[model samples]
Target: MPFKTEEMLLNVGPQHPSTHGVLHLEVTTDGELVTNAEPTIGYLHRCFEKYAETLTYQQIIPYTDRLDYLSSMNNNFGFVVAVEKLMGISVCERAERIRVIMAELNRIASHLMFIGSFSNDLGAMTPFLWCFRDREEILKIFEEVSGARLLYNYYRIGGLAADLTPGIEDRIHSFLNQFEAHMLELDDLFTRNAIVIARLKGVGMIPRETAIAYGLSGPMLRASGVDWDCRRDEPYSIYPSLRFEVPVGGEKLGALGDCYARYLVRRAEIDQSVSLVRQCLTDIPPGDVKEQVKRNVRPPVGEVYVRTENPRGEIGFYLRSDGSTKPSRVKVRAPSFCNMSVFNRISKDILVADMIAILGSVDIVLGEIDR
Candidate 1:
C-alpha cells in the first residue's frame, strides 16, 4: 500500500458554492482521502479596517455589520463597545438590556443557519428552508428597530440608534416563545437524528488542549471541555448582571470534541439565550438608552484592545485614537479568521465530503474571515 501511489491535486473553491462564501481550499488527496488541505482567503476582503481610518466613528458601525452579516447585531455590539470604551461611555440599564436581547437574537439567527447548512451539506434540503423560515422573524425584528433588514447599523457609540419602537418588546417576546419551539423541533429533527449523529459524533475530533492551543473560542472551545466564555468570564454590557449557564462539553461526545459536540453546544446556548432574553424582558428599566456625549467626538491619544464573545468566538477590536475626529488605526481580530486556521490541521486524512460538513459546523462567515 505504501509503494505505488501518486498524490493528486484538487482545487475546491473560490467559486464553488459548497466551499461556503468564496472559500477556496487547495486540497491534495490520495484516492478518496484528503492528504493535505490549505485554505485560501481574502476573496471577499473589502478593506473595512483601512476604510475606518477615513470615516467617523459612527460611520464604521455599518461596516462591522457586513463582516458577519448573519449576526449583524453582534457585529454592531462589538464595534460600538470599542468606540464606547474609547469615548469613556457606558450604556444605560435599559440600553444594556436591549443590547443583550438583540445580540442573543442574532446568535440564534446565525446558529439556525449552521444547523440548516450542516444538514444540507449532508444531503438534507428541508432543514435549510426551515431554518430560513425561523430566521426571517429575526430579520424582521432588526428591520423594525434599525430600518434595515440585514445591515442594521443600529448601535451608536454611547447607545443604540433609537429606542425600541412601541410593541417591539412584545413582538420579541412572541418571537422568543415561538423560537423555543423551533429549537425543540430542530433538536428532534437533527441533533438526535441517527444519520446526523453517526456522521458527526466522532468525526473531526479536536481535543480540548489542541483547541485552546490553537486559540479556539465560542462553542468550538466549549465543546472541547473548556468552560471559558467571554460573556461569563469577562462580562460587559450587563452580561455580568445576567444569569445564564455556559453549556460546555457533555458525555454524549465520548470526550471527543467533534463537529457534533460543537453543534450541541450551540444548540444548548440558544436555549440559554432564550432564558437570558426572558430575564431581560422582566428586569429592563425605563430610561434614556443613550448616554449624552459631547456633540463632537474625540478620544485620548492611546491604543486599546476590547474583545467580546461573538457567536463565532472572541471578536476583538484594536483601536488607536490620536485625540482627533477619526481613529488613527482600527484592527479587527475576527474569530472566524483564527478558527478557520485550524482547518488545515484538522482536515488532514478526511474525505472531501466530510470536509464540507466539518467546515459548515465550524460556522465561518467569509466576510468576517476576509475582512
Candidate 2:
C-alpha cells in the first residue's frame, strides 16, 4: 500500500518514563517508524539561568546543582569556573584535586544510569540492577563528602564548600578496587552481548562530520570518531595535568558511528575516569579547600564561556557579568539539548523499539535540555 497523505503526530512524553524526566517529544510517525520528532521542553524548567542572573555568585551554585541533578558536580564546576574567571580567582590545589575526584565520580554515576536504563529499554532487566548496585557505592562517596547524594551544593565559587572527612579516601580506594571489576563484568554482559550488538550496531548512525556540524560534543561526538574531549583539548580545573585518553570510536565493522559506538565510548570513559581519580588522589597538594573571598563578590563587567566534558557531552555555561553582586545573563549550552537535536534525523528510518534505545544511548536529561 502507498503511504497516506497525512502523517500521524504522536506525543511520546510529557510524562513517559522512557522520555527520562518530563521530556515531551512530538513524534510524527508513519506507522512504526518516526518521520519527524520535535522535542518539547520546559516542563521541568526551574528557570535556573534567569535565577542565576539575579543571585550572587555564591548563591548560584545551588541553582546550578539543579540543572542536571544527576551530575550536579559538573553543573557546580561549570557555573563556578565562569564566575571564577570573571573574578580572576583560582581555586586552591587541594580543592581542584577533590573537585576532579568528585566530578569524575559523578560522571561514573551518570554513566551507570545510562547503561542500566539503556539495557532496560532493550528488555534486559539484570544489567539495570547490576549497574545501579555499583552506582550506589559511588553515591555513598558523594554523600560522605557533600552530605547530600543527588543535588550536592558542595563546590563553591572559588573552592569546595568543605574538605573531605578523614578516611574518605580509603573508602574511595576500596570502592575503586571493587567498581573496576563490576564495570568489566557489566561490559562483558551487555557490550559484547549478541542481542544488544544486533540492535545497536547499525542503528541511529551519526557521521563524524555531521556530528561536528551539528555542534555535538562529548560522547556523542566522540562516538562518531571525532577526537574532541573538553578535558583534554580545552583543559580546565587541573585536567590539563591529568593523564587520560580520549576514547573516540574504534573500528567496528569498519564504521565508527552508531548507537553501539556511543556505548563503547562511554564505557571506555568510565575506566579513564577511574584512573583520573586515582591520579588526583596521589597528586592532590595539601592546602585549604576553601579560598577566602569578600562578603559581596563583584566581578568586573565581562563575559566568559566555560565547558566541561560531562557524561552527556560538552556541558557549557556562558555568563555575562556587570560590576554588580550578580550576573547579567546566564546561558547553558546543554549537551542533552544538542544530542537530542538528532532525534528527528535518526529515528525516521528506525524501528519504533529502536527509538527508545537510541534516545537512551544519547543519555539526555530533560532538566538540562529545557534549562
Candidate 3:
C-alpha cells in the first residue's frame, strides 16, 4: 500500500544539542526519510583570519586555540610550526620533545571528548561520564603546565612558554596507567554493545573516492580506507621519530567509511597517543624552555603552508609575511569545515534519525568551521 507523503523542511540546528555547535542544518524530509540536508554556518565566526592580519605572528597563537578548543595544544602546535617554517628557525630537541608530548596528550584528551560526546549523542550516557572522567586528568595536566585549561596560549614561535613542571611526568604516567583500564571497561560496555553496533555499523558510508574527493583527512579519511596521516606523511616537529600505528577501516575493525569505522579509528588513535605520551615522558631532555624569541617575530617575505594532524583532521596554516611584526595573510584550512562538506551528499534518502547519527560521526567543532 502506497501512502501519500509530502516533503517538509526541518531545521535541526543553531540551538540543537546534537548539531555539535552553533550550526544549522536545513533539512528536507519526506515523512521520516530525508531528501536533502545542508549546513548553515558562521554563527560562531570570530574573523580569525582577518584578525590575524593585524596581530603579530606570535599574537595569533591564542586565536588558533579558539578554533578547536578541545585540541588547543595541537592548534598551538600547527600555528607555531607554520610560523617557525616561515621564519626558517628551529627549537631545541628538548622543546621539540615537550611539544610532541603536549600535542599527543591533547590528542588523547580531545579523542576522549569525542568518544564521550559522540556516545552521548547516540543515547549512551555511561560512556559520556566515563570518558569525561578521564579527560579531566588531562585538563589538570594542561592547567599545571599552561596556566589555562581550555584556551592555552602556551606554544611560542620557536619554542614553548615554559618547561615541564617537576613530577608532571609521574602525573601523566599515573593517568595513563588507569586510562587504559577505563578504555577497556568502555570497550566492554559500549564498543561491543549490540545497541551501539546496530546504531552505527554500515550507516553513513563514505567510500574511499568520495572521501578523497571531499578532501577529508585524519580519521574521516582513514575510516574510509585511506591510510594517510599528516603527522607521518608530512613529517614535522618530532613526529618523524615517534612510532605509532595509524588505524584505518579494516575487516577486523570496521567496514569501510561507516560511522563505526570512524569510532574505531579514533578509539585506536587514543592508544597510539598513549604510546606517544609515554615515549615523550621518558625522554624529555633538559633545556631552557622559555618564551623563546621576542614578541615581534618577522619572517621573510614569503608564503608557506604547514599542516599538522589534529584530532578532527588536518589543520593547515597558510601564512604570508611581509617581513614585519604581523602577517599580511593568514588562512586556516580547518578540518571540520572540509569534513562537513560531504554530509548532505551522504544524507540523501536516509531516515531522518540516521541523518543525526551521520552528523554526530562527522564530529565537527563549529568554532573551526565558522572561522
Which predicted model would earn the best TM-score? Answer: 3
* Candidate 2, poorest ten consecutive residues by summed lDDT: 248-257
User: Relative to the true structure, how large is the alpha-carbon lDDT of every model?
Assistant: 0.86, 0.86, 0.91
**lDDT value, residue 367 of candidate 3:** 89
In model 1, where do residues sit more than 4 Å from their true spots? 1-4, 252-254
Q: Candidate 2: which stretches are off by over 4 Å?
A: 1-7, 252-254
TM-score of predicted model 3? 0.98
Give the RMSD in angstroms, all C-alphas superposed, for model 3: 1.1
Clashing pairs in 2: none
Model 1 TM-score is 0.96
C-alpha TM-score for every candidate: 0.96, 0.96, 0.98
Off by over 4 Å in 3: 1-3
Estimate, for each residue in 16-35, the C-alpha lDDT of model 1 and write its tens digit: 86777899899999999999
Q: In terms of TM-score, which candidate is stronger, 2 or 3?
A: 3
Order the numbered candidates by lDDT, best leading: 3, 1, 2
Clashes of 1: 0
